[model samples]
Target: MSALTGKVVALTGGVGGAKLARGLIECLAPDQLLIVANTGDDFNHLGLSISPDLDSVMYALADLNDPQRGWGLAGESWQAMDALQQLGGADWFKLGDRDIATHLQRSVRLREGASLSQVTRELCAALGIQHRLVPMTNDRVSTMITTEQGELAFQEYFVREQCAPAVSAFRFDGIELAQPLPELMDWLAAPDLEAIIVCPSNPFVSVDPILQLRGVRAAIQAATAPVVAVSPIVGGLAVKGPAAKMMKELNMPATATAVAQWYGELLDGLMIDVVDRELVDTIETKTRVLPTLMSDLESKVDLAQAAIDFARQLD
Candidate 1:
């Protein structure tokens, strides 16, 4: 744990982010980490609200995550999805049976006028996840996809479209009206905050939405804690997901250097995988090299310890 006893760390995005979040959870007391999930991915499906990123983080933290799949509940069944398919519904997104329980409860709570943050907290408590898991906002903020084909909903671009669309642009609808969760802001200003770790999530889609929130980027910039990031791309490819594909489609190089450039001046240090270790010296920004992959619990713990050690070096 590197003696980072009272540090407050904020994380963003889904699977990639959640992996590091899980690592931190293993090493830190639950209260020491605050997860600021990207609510821009929030959407309504089959008349029910769904927050993919939030659910992934929650599932990962509760130790109920499916390691092989990288997302959703462990031992999940597709009963509801199969039934929905028989009824001619859009089962293209693949919502698992166990995962549906979360959506069902969240949907009911939301219908009763509870905020997303409130519902999330309740869900975390029920799952026995003691860390603070917060949505970027309780307000509506959907990530709209602008591609060569046309503007599509997030899931359509990601799942149905299989991320084949040539990237044009993206915008968070209703973001102008969105406010950062108060608790997140308070934590950002916490006296005990040691460093802010931007998990190795997709820079444009995953992390950008949270950065675009009204005062979020500014708050992160102004915070006293040093901010660090792990690159999702390794050896010119994404460790997982379509991050590298999106970068190429967006006319950017698929390299650790590109990831550093995307983050620009925001990060105090950048962590790249051993595969890209050679490029560390060529990176445009101040950075560090480490084995970024967390294949097992031991590796996750080592990565978490490396992060804290890196932060201490900055001090």
Candidate 2:
């Protein structure tokens, strides 16, 4: 395939989405790509602002991510978490020594009147990441997972509770009041914009929170760019995280078709794994069958290229 031209914006969540973001970064120049990360998972942990998805994307782009654990810095040490446990502090969420430094720096900057987007840009630069990375919104928006036990904060349900609760629904606490980042809005309005690639992120919590932000969905709908989504589910199961489990609990089928349906009319095309090729006939939008698993760099770049090529074809 020829070189991908024009600016492309990728909407991503934590690990799964970050993998694709890294692929896109490799496929395009720093100026040609922009990553909008989910900040719904952001919370104040141990009195420090923690943006899990942002950190994950940054780590991935900088080649500092721990592939084995699927999160945090590679060669990470857990001296802090170990000490916290010995001091009888909450140790459910493991924060490694290097990881804590990120949080501490971000927390300080945020308290110093820096916007989340500004802080993220600075952090990305510090990590030597060239491609632009922005949070979905600078405004505070928390994802609340409503489950059998009750409504719980995102991290409380995802990490502390280990995603054990059966989720019935989800809500973005401050989404109604949140505004899309100015840079993202400008990109959506740019005449030369090419495509919007929705990374294979959790539809309910990861991608939904960004969509629920005021005017974000409408902007994408109105943009001239064709929106394409990569399925997070492969062969009826989520590659990582609790997406599949959440889907089943919400009475939706744990299938690629269901994932497409959840995104609805916003999608111009949907990319499904080869294992889910059977779902093509049932999927409502235009479909592209490829191996969506990102077990390594090659697969991730190939899938990223496929998704972009499919979107270009739609044009």
Candidate 3:
């Protein structure tokens, strides 16, 4: 029998998180999984509201994400980007022709006064994704990266600057007024919730923003389900983004133990990579060392199963 049988709530970001999300979808029934994606990376580009993390998760679930690039649809064409470049338009963030359709539809719906969650649901239905995927909140919560140069928007620091600036700290603007999704709160309060898995995403920008939402941390702490996290850092390096660099810039060691410390008491257990097995004794929470790297589909599935199994054992 699968260890992940009951309803599971997963908090995730883009790329790394989506890869594991795909694995979880493969392992669990459609109704058994609920994904809450980070919206901190969202921004307005060319008058279109682009949600990078949400699109990444949705594409992964729909089997349309490009594995090589770790973002955007597979077999995508960049004709639109090329045309924009020809017109002297800013192309720092490449938006492919296929991806443009998603943004266009979402922008129209949003302009028509639909909530982000509602629009996301419609998009998921169109993409044939069975599992539920939700943004952290409908309200705007931009990730502000404070660096030596100055404060830069999340996308500017990440994409435009190529993360070259020395990171000092991070702040989620508008987070104070941001509300957690009503369904998410209800799920946390549900009596039969099996687990809450924090995917291997960037703690500072991705997962922290979700946890920082009003009443979210308290809800997780009060939940009946065990909360588990898969460390994004493996062998002192991040699987994709600049998580490791951020950790170092913030005067923290880039290790799985540091990640466990970041999540602290909210986590009942943590799944670290085998490469960081030696640091297990230092982790405050219950720890399971496994191959956390998701280089391929099979690896992603195995790691997902291992995390679910670990969370079940915690109960």
Candidate 4:
């Protein structure tokens, strides 16, 4: 066993998740990490399969991430989106030129009969990212939110609608039929698996979708490794996205304590920001107060180190 080496982790969600994931990749050996990105936001746009979460994770790992925007490729140009706008197309989804290359390649591969996993692996290899990155499933499952405006796809509710719709409920369409990616299952079942870090992502839309997969929750609960979650909520606010608002709409407090409660008994430890240290004792799960915000590379690495240390101590 690789001692400090044999660790395996599975993460879901998008940019925020990717930030911590990049940090973890720096801390752990590449083979020791496995990121399971959320596909809930995935949808067909202009008859093309667009997977925002997966691409974000992949780009972040590949070191091609746009830090300023926090979501697409660095130094990107929006030619595709510009062209679509000129054609008077629905340009709600902005696909930059560099990012569009990734989408086009992925679309073409899928069209040629490649599974999402296979394409992801190929992309990872090409990008020189050594760690394993897998999608939640092989089947088409989308998170549809029932909001005041009506049922909106995750991206439509998030990106296009700017999350303006008051979410009444959410359903993962086709989740019942979605099969866990075999490679992910194999990694989860690995004997040396040491920890799972649920990244500081929007729990409702990001992590929840992955957990909703038929066997994923059960597998996580049954894993010999300890499961730790970093709270996206800090000081009654979300650092990146709409988690806080969504939580409030769901009648839950926008706090780390509430985030831990949402996870229920699934978590062995909850990583909260030092800003919310006072709420540590109030959390349902055991807590570790750290600087959870990944404002820069150092902060991200520090949080990742803290999480890995906590998990190792637990083991």
1-315 per-residue lDDT for model 2 (tens digits)? 327678898999999999999899878888888899999999998998999999999999999999999999999999989989999998988899999999999999999999999999999989999899999999999999999999999999999899999999998998888988989998888787789999999999999998888888999999889999999999989999999999999999999999999999999999999999988999999999988889899988888888778888997
How many Å off is the CA of 164 in candidate 4? 0.6
Model 4 earns a TM-score of 0.97
Return model 2's CA RMSD, one decimal: 1.0
The residue ranges of model 3 lying beyond 4 angstroms of the native Cα positions read 1-5
**lDDT of model 3, residue 38:** 97
lDDT per residue for candidate 3 within 121-176, as digits (tens), equals 99999999888999999999999999999999999999999999999989999999
RMSD each, Å: 1.2, 1.0, 1.1, 1.5
Model 4 residue pairs with clashes: none
Cα lDDT tens digits for candidate 4, 1-315:
224667667576888999998888888887788889989888888777888899989999888999889899999998878989999998988888888778888899999999998999999999999988889887899999999999998888999999998888899999999997876777777888889899998898899988888888888888898998899998999988889999988999999999999999999999998899899679878888878889788888888888888888777
Candidate 2: residue 173 lDDT (0-100):
94
Query: lDDT per prediction?
Result: 0.85, 0.93, 0.93, 0.87
| lDDT-based ranking | 3, 2, 4, 1
Look at candidate 2 and give me any clashing residue pairs.
none
For candidate 3, what is the total of clashing residue pairs? Answer: 0
How many clashing pairs does model 2 include?
Answer: 0
lDDT of 1 by residue, 182-244 (tens): 887887788788888888888888899888888888888888888888889989989777899
Evaluated against the true structure, the overall lDDT of model 2 is 0.93
lDDT-superior candidate, 2 or 4: 2
